[model samples]
Target: MPDPTATQALGRFVAGSDWRDIPAALRHEAKRSILNHVGCALGTARDPAVQAALRVMRGLGGAPAATVFGQGARLDPMGAAFVNAVASNLLDYDDTHLDTVIHPAAPVAPPLFALAEQRGLPGAAVLHAFLLGGEVACRIGNAVSPGHYARGWHITSTCGAFGAAAGCAGLLGLSAEQVAHAIGIASSEAAGTVENLPNAAKNVSVGNAARHGILAAMFAAEGYDAAPAAIEGPLGWARAAGDAADVAAITEGLGTRWEIGRNTYKPYPAGIVFHAVIDACLELRARLDAPPEAIAAVTVAGDALLLARGDRAVRNARDSRVSIHHSAALGLLRGRAGVADFEQPAVDDPALAGFRAKVTAALDAALPRGAARVTVRLANGREEETTVLTPRGSEARPLTDAELEAKYHENAALGGCADRAAAQIAAIWGLEEAADLGHLTALLA
Candidate 1:
């Protein structure tokens, strides 16, 4: 292969990793991320944002090559991957690699699925590629890290394009050099911004990442070459987009320490950082006897990361889903932050806003990323406090298979497909044994 830059190493792994030799825990984590992403995609497939996007895409239709999950229309492979990715991320309920805050599966799995379905690939291949892609994405993400993220780059899209392309390249059984070219080609188009998170644009970024990956691999398959040092060269992706790269994070321990093994799913639809706040508020709610009106204030103390992403005013459901205020309000008033709790009706509800105004988030340098302390002060002169060191779904407190299955059902129901959810769940759990991709395609609709 070309010079041993970061992308080439990642490409080699993507193209050459043996599925049979992958550790069981890493494989399970891959399945967990897959199950989480599939549920998220199904739930939001018919959402307004997706509907609008579908309309535009259908108007500019290409070959009917691949199915858009939860929709009848089959779009071109790229278009299908893009729409499926958007649907997966629309709810912001997918899994997250907390170290980089990148939702790995959203971008990687969509292209893998789209390409696999079009090629009639088996579930095992899709599953293996998905995991491999996630590893590549997260490692690249780890290299640029807080610097890339703090600089307003949406690491999921920026780093994910590489992962998506790498995975798709592997799924297509491309050579290591071809995989390297795919990674390099994707580097040229990597982008997304933190400013778009509260709007449909965020999903567009994710979708674009998925589409760009497929296109990158397609171009590479045709012998197109990217700059050899596309990812780590002085003027390449890392230097251009991020302040610095931790080379060690990207190059150390290839298959031994899998990044996907550290993935965490969201129990709430909101940003993962606010999950601890949700946990805290729900715990405080349990200790209260008075009505919502009796609560004078709710204070949430967490890492500075919480304030960076979660502390925001919620004018609509889009804003509400990423707002700590809504998370707190839902937990205190409704005792849960389900998918429906972040709906338009909830955003417009006066009581929700009133409850929101009482909640405040304070930056605490001492607390870990997933930990938070919530205190509620009541008009009755009572106070209750709860600290969640490990919110549910964190690797430290992973959701049980039963809990994850419940999550799948809840999400699948949102797309009005509860009737098919059970079967879909069964298929995903038994994905390795599946004979073909037909069952997955059918479930999407």
Candidate 2:
């Protein structure tokens, strides 16, 4: 017999896992990821993109089984999953696994939360499901690596379907065989292209992954069947979705060391890869004695991937969040970068645009993926440079618990629901003790 397949292993983990069996550290990380995901989702639940998507989903008229986060609307579990996933990721501020650049929580948590509420599940169970999902996401993400991402596939939504499916499967108490079927079913539906990254549809891709993954697990729980080798078999997910595969990455030490431990948060709303440039530029800005106009030219050097992904002009809020010029400009000229910095009026500022024009980004093959150097040339012939070897939100320099709580409030305020933040945070921290998710859902809604 061929060795166990990826689908089989993942299914076994999802069904066989016991919350008490997992380590305390892993459980804690799961809570952190959950808090971060909820904060991010609540923050952007009112965005135009999210609102528009919600409008469409609500118009479809499904059963009102779950809350739609800050929107205060109830929809079917699938609709809730779709809308919450979009909101979680619409800001591009969700948790990321550096090895795969996958926003691990956005696609998984929405489905998990929706199902937990639908089933009146306790927070402890929800946490367990979330951990299982995130682990599957990062491991599969590792299996595909740069090959899956470079080929124009958005790994978050692609691999994330598996995570969402596993999470929901765990919640539904599916058996190992049925959970494997869920993964197989999800593989057939997983898809998201980088070509969609520049618009609202990028968020839609993640939303689809969340919604569809839930549907897959729900179907599997009802006796749906799929190929046992759907993930690692020839002509399977690994070969079809990526140029190459690292089978060992998926199965080696699968359950021993937790991959979710490495999940990192973003301090800024922009892309994670651009964070080093933002850090360096902010440091240079702090040292400047001159006005915003003093800078003659700015130069940014970083890894080839950074330049390729971030070297673009800012024309709108969505573009601003991913642009190297916008990050360099806002950091140096304003001495700050935040969600507001990437929004309208701020993005339309003439002074920032002037600085935007002067910034040039180049690729350095030797620099690490998350490291950057920024050099500023002043009009009076003075040039200063700063290099950031470790960005603030990377695993090397993570945000503390207090900082994460502050971030949650900041996001809640941005979402116009700051008054609800304290209660939500309290409930999240005390999740395991709650009787069910109803109180939490009401607070979020």
Model 1, residue 358: C-alpha shift (Å): 1.2
For candidate 2, which ten residues in a row score worst on lDDT? 242-251
For candidate 2, what is the lDDT?
0.88
Ten consecutive residues with minimal summed lDDT in candidate 1?
Answer: 1-10
Q: What tens digits encode model 2's per-residue C-alpha lDDT throughout 67-175?
A: 9989879998889999999999988889989878899898999888888888889999989998888888889899888888888899999999988998889888999
Models 1 onward score TM values of 0.97, 0.97
Best by lDDT: 2
Give per-residue CA lDDT, model 1, range 302-398, as digits (tens): 8878888888888888898778888989998988888889999999988898889999889889999878898899997788888999898888988
Give me candidate 1's TM-score against the actual structure: 0.97
The local distance difference test score of model 1 is: 0.86
